[model samples]
Target: MDALEILFTASFWVAAIRIASPLIFATMGELICERAGVLNLGIEGIMTAGAFAGWFTVYAGGDLWTGVLVAALAGAMFGLLHATLTVPLGLSQHVVGIGVTLLATSLTYFIYRLALPEVTSPPKIEPFQPLPIPGLSKVPVLGEALFSQTPLTYLAFLTVAVVAWVLYRTPVGLAVRAAGENPSAVEAQGISVTAIRMGAVMVGSALMAVGGAFLTMSAFNSFFFEMINGRGWICIALVVFGSWRPGKALIGAILFAAFDAYQVRLQQMSGGIVPYQVFLMMPYALSILALILVARRATYPKALMIPYQKGER
Candidate 1:
């Protein structure tokens, strides 16, 4: 009935989780890339391509899961492209990333036009329904809000713990971190820096693709031009805000999602007391402020953006 009551409801949080799901996926993808010392500005385009891949597959009579797979594969291909250009070829990471984004964006649009030329309205697909956990859904306030989530949301949260473990406790995780911070030293340790970086980009882009697929298959159930908006860029910021850790990235994503969810509700409740666009701006503006607050405290990999060729400093 009132602001506090509206804010405290389970339904509101359910929306928050839904909005944050894609962001969580994107953040983790970028985290993986950055951990291996590759700054992926192609994230926006990769997500865009993923959305198109999923939507196109489902529209062409494939099932949702298959569409998801296609999306992941599509993302992986782009990641490989990025790795090929930036790693072995020794191209500039920034330039390659921007080129990948531009190429993916244009290519996706061209494919869309070629596939469905007579469409006046955007096509749609059946999205995943929320699955509520048995006992967990019985709790008040937190139950349905946290437990009654789509499968993708559950995966997103679960990934937090999994990634934290992988990064902190596993040898592969150490290699990923080491690759970004000191590739030369890592090379000296008998590891192929190129191989590790290549693998990281491939895996990271695949996850980023899944995030984009989540938007199409779960979040909205349809694909529109530039639907990814700037969420990919926001995710880049989130990685910085989270200090490249899964737990922190998840927190930052949820925080931004909360602002996003509240803004939508506020527009309905305020009845034009505030402009809707102003509400939309809340998340990005908050991100800037959050980045500013944490910028000084943030720690980044030492040798990030430096390419490693054998016997070269």
Candidate 2:
């Protein structure tokens, strides 16, 4: 293909991966948590909290890496809060998640307002540069498109593979699945369902936080108000679309991103065949379709969304 054709064809795919990265990471996190019997609606809130923490870290120290670390730590703290309220207190998961979301959003906005005090000089940082693979960059059409991406981009793919293995190929994976499907049965076998679920939430929250941090520290280098923009809900959709499987969910996340990326391209195209707002709705629309497919499959975990009491079935 000619250079112009290559650029036109590759642009959408590149944008797709870029858009999909955060969702991929966050959905994987949600998969872990849900597979442990917790439907964490607080993902949106957790992401917002991470965005603020990462932005603040960069603003204070002028280092993106530091911001990432701080964001992960903040996420873990949120996860702990989630576990405490839902696991021990036995609060309703939906209510607790919404509360966490509200708290995180309020806290983020409050801290951002306090730090800047004015929008005239909002804090910003330099985004991470993409690193092209050696020799691979010279390949025909695929080189620049695939081999040239940020470190985190590669890490996102690796996470999918690793999570898939840990969730399906190991003993710990079996235990987590058992705990989610039938916590009472797992507990009868001497496994601590509470501990397993707690671990899942903590790890999942950390991943979600990094997904938020990626927006500030890598994608844009500056945080804006409500930067996450419903990406968390998208993650939940991806988990359902993937049937709670890590690898399949990653593909679904990429497909969702592709829809988003295609919309941007459509806006730039000459004829303007598709309305901007309609294009923007594509991801959510696709997610709704996915939800329908899940309903048909009926593959949800038996114990999903149920609060486990210590001695109850």
Choose the strongest candidate by lDDT.
Answer: 1
Worst 10 residues of 1 by lDDT: 1-10
- Model 1 TM: 0.97
RMSD (Å) of each candidate, 1 decimal: 1.2, 2.4
lDDT of each: 0.89, 0.82
How close to the true structure is residue 130 of candidate 1, measured as C-alpha lDDT?
85
| Model 1 pairs whose backbones collide | none
Report how far residue 102 has shifted in candidate 1, in Å.
1.1
Residue-level lDDT tens digits of model 1 in 1-313: 6877877998998898889999998899999899998888889999999999987899899988898889989999999999999988889999999999999999999999998899978888888788999999879877878898888788888877877888789988888899999998888888998998999888888888889989988888888998999899899999999999899999999988988888888889989978888988888888888889889999988767888888998
lDDT of 2 by residue, 1-313 (tens): 3323534565556667778888888998899999998888889989988888987887887576777779888988899999889876778889999998898889888888887886775667777778889988557445665667787777788889988999899978888898789999888989888898888888888889888887887778788877898999989989988999998898898878877776666666635666677777877788888888787885887777888888876
Error of 2 at 302 (Å): 1.4
TM-score of each: 0.97, 0.93
Model 2 local distance difference test score? 0.82
The list of candidate 2 runs beyond 4 A from truth reads 1-8, 270-274
- Misplaced by over 4 Å in model 1 are none
